[model samples]
Structures are given as C-alpha cells and as structure tokens.
Target chain A: MREDFQDELTRVNRTLVTMAKAVREAMRQASSALLTSDHTMAQQVTARDAEIDVLYRVVEDRVYDLVARQQPVAGELRKVLTALQVAADLERMGDLSVHVARAALRRHPAPAVVPELADLFREMSTVADGLAAKIVSALADQDAVLAAQLDRDDDAMDHLHRELFSVMLSPRWPLGVEAAIDGALLGRYYERYADHAVNVGHFVVFLASGKDD
Target chain B: MREDFQDELTRVNRTLVTMAKAVREAMRQASSALLTSDHTMAQQVTARDAEIDVLYRVVEDRVYDLVARQQPVAGELRKVLTALQVAADLERMGDLSVHVARAALRRHPAPAVVPELADLFREMSTVADGLAAKIVSALADQDAVLAAQLDRDDDAMDHLHRELFSVMLSPRWPLGVEAAIDGALLGRYYERYADHAVNVGHFVVFLASGKDD
Candidate 1:
C-alpha cells in the first residue's frame, strides 16, 4: 500500500513537471506571437490554457485524496501540499501567458518595440523558461542544490526586469506613452512569472530541509 | 487525544480571526491615511504589518504541527488546511495594505489623485476592508452563504478598478503620463487585494461544499 501511494505521488509529480513544460512552451510561443504579431499562435496559446486548468484541478483533487486517505506524515504531507500550491501558481502562470497572448493579439501588425527591447524580453523569457525547467528537475530529483540555484536565477530575471523599466523610463526611447505602459506591464508579467518559479524552488528547498523558511 | 487536537485547532482559528481583524484595521488605517494624506497613519499601518507577519508564521507552524502529529482526517483535515490557506491570504492582504500605505506616503500632505479619483479609491478601500471582515467571519463561523455574498462584493471592486483605468486612459487628466501609470498600478493592487479576499471566500465555500468547484 505504501509503495502504491508512492507511485501515485510520483505520478502527480510527473503531471506537474509536464504542466510546467507546457507553460514554458506556451510562454515561448506567446513571445514569438508578440514579436511576429501572429494571431494564430496567440490564439493557440489562449486555447491551450484550458488544458493547464484541467490539469490543475486534477492534481488538486489527487492531493486532497492523498491527504485524506494516506494521512501523509511529515515529509510526504509537505510534498503533497507544496504540489497543490505549486499547481495553483503554475495555473496562474498559464493564465499570464494567455494574457500576454491576448495583448499580442490586440496589437498585431503594429511595429515591435525596438530590437533592443525585444532582445530584453527574449532574454527574460529565456531565463524564466530555464527557471521553470530547473524547478521541475529539482522536484523530480529532490535536489535542494538545484532548487537553490534556481532561486539565484530569479535574481537575474529581476535585474533584467529593472533594466527594462529603466529603458522605459529613459528619454532614449521615442516610444509613445502607450508603448511604455505596455512595456512596463509586460516586464512586470515576466518578473512575476520568475517570482512564482522561485516560489516553487522555495517549496522544494523546504521539503528538503524539513523546515519552512 | 482527539478532543485535545480539536481544542488546539480551535486556538489556531481564534488566532487567525484575530490576525484577520488586525489586518482589516490596518487596511482601514491605510485608506484613511490616503484620504486625508495622513503620513502618521500610513506609517502606523506599515509598522503593523510585521506583527501580522509574525502571527501568520506562528499560525502556520501550529497548523503544520497539528497536521503532522494529529493526523486529522476528512472534514478535520479540510478545516485545518482551510485555516492555513486563509491565514496566508490574510497575511498577503496585510502586505497589500502596506503597499497602499507606501503609496499614501509618496503622496503625503495632499491627496494623490484628484478629488473624484480619491473618492473612488476611498470606496475601493471600504469595500476591501468590508470584504476582509466578511471573509474572517465566514471562516470563523463556517458560513458558506456569507462567503458567497462576499464573493459578489468583489464585483464592486472590479468595477472601480476598471473605472480607475478608464480615468487614467482618458485625455482629461492633466497630470499626464505619470499619473496614468500610477493610477493603473494602484488600481491593480486594489483589484488584486479584492481578488485574494474572494479567493478566501472560495476556500470557505469549498470547505462547506466538499467540492473543488
């Protein structure tokens, strides 16, 4: 029975990892859609959010069942509860991707931000995607070290976010006020996405340390 | 032993209710500060957030201990977990109040927005304060009906947030670009606070209904 419970728990983790991967892909696709003003890809990412939502609900139900039936002790209970919270965060991340896609759709055929700003966004997306991947791996392997490294990666995203804001605030960009607002919001979304990934890494660290910090 | 566990859980609930009340009061103080441009009150609210944080951590530790040692089942586990999550939401609400206070500080000696916009913010704060109070009571009493009602109250906040944005977007505001950006961010913060309160209500409904939806 214990082995079966572990198997079920592993299955849930696998689902979460897959969900994280999908979110990362969705983000990349949404960014491309934004750069190219591809309405079709933007719509595709928006539509795919339902899959993330469904997975979230499924994982939540399973975690609740595990707690109820297994009466998970100490480390096991922490793992399940963290998984539940991370699932909620991941689902929200998916929603943010949809938000980005919708914004892309709204401004389609418009000129992109200068190549520099575009590069900054691409770099932000790449860091976020890397952080998401590391979180999944950390959880799967219970690697506290890797999780800690992901936490540091979040700092890089923050720095990039601040840099983006500085650019928006600077007089160098002849971008209109509306463009600046959009850029600020986009930078915020990316920074927040990275923050959530760091949150997941913190959960992993807590599980490994057996202490909530 | 079960009775003792129940009693301890009750203590946790009592502390949570107290913490929620404190947070609501802090939010009220912050709004009053904003309305009056009272730096003292704003500072007071900001200072009180640490107390809320400390209380939240204590409640969190106790809840985890209860779950680990008592091994609560079914309804009991649900109740405990709901309390834990609600505590977290309340803490975040407190943080939001601090954000408002900081904003208030930035605009001290005179109201930040124009009179009409300030009134809108005042109204948002009132709804937010009321929503927090209702969520606390709903959780304390296990009143799903009250919780659902609070959920609807969130709509008023959403409307105000949209109106704030519309005001920002309008060409009428002489404050120009900076005001629009500040208004947008402030509106977003309030909307998110209301959303968290609604989330607390959803958790209450979940506890009462035993269903994820």
Candidate 2:
C-alpha cells in the first residue's frame, strides 16, 4: 500500500514536470510568433492552449484524487499541495502565452512591436524564455536554491517592462495610441508570465523547506 | 478527533470569509480614492495592503497546517483545498485593488482619470465594488448559483473596460499618451479585480458541486 502511494506521488511530480515543459514551449512559441508575426505559429499557440488547459484540469483532478485516497500528511501533503499551486502557475503561463499569441494574430501581417520598440520586446522575450527554462529545472530538481534565484531573474523582466513604459509614456513616442496600447499590453503579458514562473518557484521553495506553521 | 477536524475546517471557512470582507473593503476604498483623488484614502489603501499581505500569508500557513495535521479526505478534503484556492483568489483581488490605489497615489495632486473618462471610471468602480460584495456573500453562503451569477456581473465591468478603451484608442482621443496609458491600465486593473471575484465564485461552485475527478 505504501509503495503504491509512493508511486502515485512520483506520478504527480512527473505530471507536474510535463506540464512545466508544455508551459515553457507555449511561451517560446508565443514569443516567437509575436516577434515575427508568424501567423501559423501564433495560430498554433492559440490552438494548443486548449490542450494545456486540459492538462491543467487533469493535474488538478489528480491532486484531488491523491489527497483523498492517500490522506498524505506533513511533507507529502505539502508536496502535493505545492504541485497544485505550481500547475496553476503554469496554467496561467499558458494562458498568458495565448494572450501574446492573440496579440500577434490580431494584427496578422503587421508585427505587434513597432520598429522603435522591437528590440526592447525581443529582450523581454529572452528574459521570459530564460525564466521559463529555470522554472522547468527548478521543478525537476526540486532545487529551492535555484528556484529562489528566479525572483532575481524576474527583476530583469520588470526592468524591461518599465523601460517599455518609458518609451510609451515618453513625450516623443512616435507610435501613437494603437501601437502604444499593444506595446504596453504585450510588455505586461511577458512580465506577468515571468512573475507566474517566480510564483511556481516560490511554491517549490516552500515545499522544499517545509517551514510552514 | 473527527470533530476537531470539522471545527478546524469551520475555522478555515471563517478566516476566508474575513479575508473576503477585507478584500471587498479594500476595493471600495481604492475605487473611491481613484475616482476622487482622495490622497488620504489612496495612502490608506497602500498602507493597508501590508496587512492584507500578512493576512494572506497567515491564511496560507493555516491551510498548510490543517492539511498536514488533519489529512482530510473526500468532501472534507475538497472544502479545505477550495478554501486555499479561494483565499488565493481574494489575495489577488487585494493586490489588484492596491494597483488601483497606487495609480491614484502616483498622481496625487492631479487626478488619474481625465474629466471625460472620470465618469466612466466612476461607473467601473461601482461595478467592481458590487462584484466584490457578491464574492463575499458567495463565500459566506457557499452559494454556487449566486457565485456563478457573479461571472455575468463581471460582464458589466468588461463592457465598461471596452468603453474606456474605445475612448483611449480612437483617433480623436484628446488626452495624450500618458493619460491614455493611465486610463488603459486602470481599466485593466478594475477588470482584473472583477475577474478574480469570478474565479473565487467558480471555486465555490466547484467545491459545492464536489466534482473533482
């Protein structure tokens, strides 16, 4: 019975890791599709979101079943609960990626980022993708230390987000209202995507430390 | 022992209801502050956020302890888990309210909303506060039907959001880039606050239904 419970716990972690990978790929595809105005890729991200949603719902169901059946206590309960939160964070990641993709799709042939702001957005994409990779590693390794590092990594995205705002709010901003709106929203989507990664990482650290009251 | 667990579950629900009330009040103050340029109210919202954050952290710790010690199962397990998710949704509602308050605070001397959009924002505030109230009642009653109704309530806010965007994005927008940015972002903050309320409601419905796979 104990061995069966342990195997179920391992399966939970594996499912979480799989979901994390899917989230990272979603971000990557969405970011690339946004930057390049790759309609097909953007469409792909939009289409794939349903699958990610299904995976997220499946994870939630699994967590509920594990808790009900195993009645896991202490460290085991914490791990299972953390998996639920992490899956939620990843689910948002996927949703935000879809948001990014929709922005691209909304303006098909025309790239969402105007010329002056393209480089800034490209930088944000790098920050977001880097953080997504870190989230995957942190989940797989249960590396609280590395997961802790993701908070600092998120600061870079925040800085870039502020930088994007600076351009949008600048008196000399030539992009006008529509493009500025697009730029601001996209900057936020990427920054928020990174923030969710940090959230998942924080949950990992909490479970790793088991330091709750 | 079983009675103790049930009592703890009751305590969890009470704390969540308290948190829900706090979140509702926070939105009221923040929205009033935003519309009126009430610097003191805005400052209060910012200061009060720390307390809300503390409450959120405390609720998290309490949930962890309950889950660890009780090892609740079936309906009991679902209720405990649902409380955790609901608390999180309320926590985010608090954060979004803080964002609204800060937007007001940032433009202390000058009101954030221009005169034309001010009435629109004031209307949005009314919708948000109404939704927040509904969330609290939903949590208190565990009324999945009432909770489900809040999603439709959120549509009013979404409509207002689109109304605000229409003004900001139109070619005739007299307000320059900065004000437009403020309007756009504030609209979003309010819309998201309502969305979180919907999320809390949905969780309530899920728990009430006891439909986890």
Best by TM-score: 2
lDDT of 1 by residue, A24-69 (tens): 8888888788777888999999999999999998887787778887
Give the runs in model 2 whose Cα sits over 4 Å from its true position: A1-5, B1-3, B211-213
Query: How far off is residue B90 in model 1, in Å?
Result: 2.0
Best-performing candidate as measured by lDDT: 2
What proportion of true contacts does candidate 1 retain?
0.24
- Output DockQ, candidate 1: 0.43
- Model 1 lDDT per residue over B85-170, tens place: 78878888898888888878986776655574887888888899889889789878877889899867899999888787666656
The deviation in Å at residue B161 for candidate 2 is 1.2
The sequence of per-residue lDDT tens digits that candidate 2 reaches over residues A59-169 is: 888888988887777677777887888888899999999999999999889988888898998899998889889888888887889889998889999999999999888
Clashes found in each candidate (C-alpha, N, C closer than 3 A): 0, 0
Interface CA RMSD of each prediction in angstroms: 2.1, 1.5
